[model samples]
Target: MVTPRLRHPVRRIGDRDIDFSRRLAVMAIVNRTPDSFYDRGATFALEAAVASGRAAFEAGADVVDVGGVKFAPGPPVPVAEEIDRVVPVVRALAPFGPVSVDTFQPEVARAAIDAGAAVINDTTGVHDPRIADVVADSDATLVVAHSLAAPRTQLPLPHYDDVVAEVRDFLEHRVAVAREHGVPAERIIVDPGHDLNKNTRHSLELTRRLGEFADIGLPMLVALSNKDFIGEALGRDRDQRLHGSLAAAVFCATQGARMVRVHNVRETVDALRMVEAILGWREPAYLLHNMRSEGNE
Candidate 1:
């Protein structure tokens, strides 16, 4: 269901263009929040955060997604504090590849863009118009994620009659708003926002019906890395969800998701590459690994 405008071999994020026709991009998560759900503040320090970015890039991540605050209703971090947390890391990682700052604040987005971030990963679906304006005024790409509540807030009860249909509708509207505000289609990405205000069932349904997102006609970014749904589905804990995460990621890629934001960089890169090779999107790194020829022996 992807339209002609959205079916492209390459997409221009900021100063870089990535080929998505035959491969899926890996967006590594570099969280600077002490209360982040996964790492639990392991990379909160500035030096550690920078080092994590470097490590992820070295591990084959196509993009680095830097976040200052955890998305789990924590103490309010001043805008200045948030800027201090992510800007330096973004600056350090920008030279390596495209860096996406995960924030919904317009001021923060502007600061991150100034700090050399190439994308704004707004998990709030650009609830604030100023954020859209900021993206429109800049050369950065915008990731429009569909979430029902504000970032870091616990929802009362999440319910959706048809999760995929509703999510698509939300993304369609947000994409339209971004376009109307002057952000080109080439600069826009869509995410269904797995586990962001949704319960386990909602997340699973979204994952199973991910192909439906192609109707939005934009590059899709899926963040299904060790999320709660994966945990619940397989009765695995956070650290134990890597396999589930990889499975969901592979499914998304097979379903036309262009980018997958994840925590395990090496494993994710390997899995996506395998999928690409299977689909004939990419040739094996080398075809002579275990081949036998009459002259060989």
Candidate 2:
């Protein structure tokens, strides 16, 4: 099913206002950690992270999500280190576009917001509640993602009676909590946490049924960027899953997912634009190529 078109899904994040109804936005992944499952610390250094952020924005990222630690099982990083890892990068990237700090720690989130982050893309779905408080105190946006366990912990066997329904319920509850804590409804986004604690089958189900999440009424953000679920389904590795990831991304967008958090900014941006153009939400950049000109044709 095609996404029911929205009239005005415009919302501001940090310094920019995005019209989510008309244009699909890509949130580029800029990992500051040395052990992120996908990037493997390629941008862990401060200079590298800043450069990557710039490049992603240049490549058409509507936002940059900077994370100090990977979500998969890993050694615990101290709060100070987390702050150090993300703040500089956030500051460096603030002038480029909206910056989102991918952290659940209230302290680190606060630091990033102070340093010019417009959004806190917490994966815990406000598990601590204080993280919601941090976002409530700021004029920034909050991304509530559903996850079953603490960050970096080995995800236990997932047991959802109805994965899509359960994820929608969890995100609804978290969005309500965020509103109660003073974060405006317009500034909140929801994610179903694909592959966070789910196996391949569950993730696939969620992707197929993603349209159900529109009931949440907030903009939907899907992290389908070379995730394990895609790789598992295609018998591919992380490096070989770009094609699968793009396919999933287009599926999600068609189902009303307004935002995609991805590693390949340029490719995802192009795919989303093409999808939007086909949907009549956006126009092609040029019409001359297909036109039968009087002299050229």
Candidate 3:
């Protein structure tokens, strides 16, 4: 019943090796923006962002993603300001664990890499190949995600006849683009983009059919934490969608998603650990549940 892992797995990022073949990684999001959709400025301050990253890493997050600009629309954050917002946080977090900088700008990618970020989580799906070159120049990994339009430039009534197929095709194309720009296949990861440019129905459909994306042959990443799709599907607001969010994450994990980008680090980590143990990919932490010594019922 088990399927093959990513064709090219076990890439190195920083001083660590990411074996996406069997292990699922938890990437905790720590946005430096003041108006992010979730957490809304909770980690906006430089000190606050670093502290949040520290806590997330301590809580078992495999990677801490620092983003200076919000994925949603807002007044433009100049390149210099974006660098200022995320570079420090990356510099502070890199020494302790894997750090990913979420930006589509080549300059920001370059600076973050210089600051010790090991992954470039470009939400733009390599919309600009220049950023791909930035990642290729170093040994960093790249996250190529699908978004219909540039951040803050919404696509009014974005529609897709087959969300899964379209997203897969886009990822395939972007992965090729990355390779063309010198990024190796092993250094690449694909993300379906979830609700980035998709509506609730689209997001739900993509989630339902995400396992089909394994044909793309790269380790898949899903950022479904408290997304509007879960909210709209369950008729719950952002703060009330933890259960729904975890459900979607576990669903994707079962579909062979290699990484999950999330806001609730501890809860998400616990959920993924449970999933891994259930799938027999990991041993439970000293199982005693059914042992006679433990007095099973």
| TM-score sort, best first | 2, 3, 1
Tens digits of per-residue lDDT for model 1, 6-120: 5455887656678776668999999999889999999999999999999999999889999998777766789999999999999898998889999988899999999999999
lDDT of 3 at 138: 94
TM-score of each: 0.95, 0.96, 0.96
Give Cα distance to truth, residue 195, candidate 2, Å: 0.4
Clashing pairs in 3: 73-152
**For candidate 1, which ten residues in a row score worst on lDDT?**
1-10
Instruction: For candidate 2, write residues 1-297 as lDDT tens digits.
Output: 455344337888877788887879999999998888898889999999999999999999999999998888877899999999999998899998999999989999899999999999989898878888988998999999999887779878889899998998889898888888888888888899999999999999999988887666788899989998999999998899999999999999989899999999999999999998988988789887668867877
Weakest ten-residue segment in model 2 by summed lDDT: 1-10
lDDT of 3 by residue, 1-297 (tens): 224357787878777787777688999999999888999898999889999999999999999999998888767789999999999999899999999999999999999999999999999899889999999999899999999797668788998988888998899999999999999988998999988888989988988888788767788889999999999999998899999989988989888788999999999999999988887888989956566654545
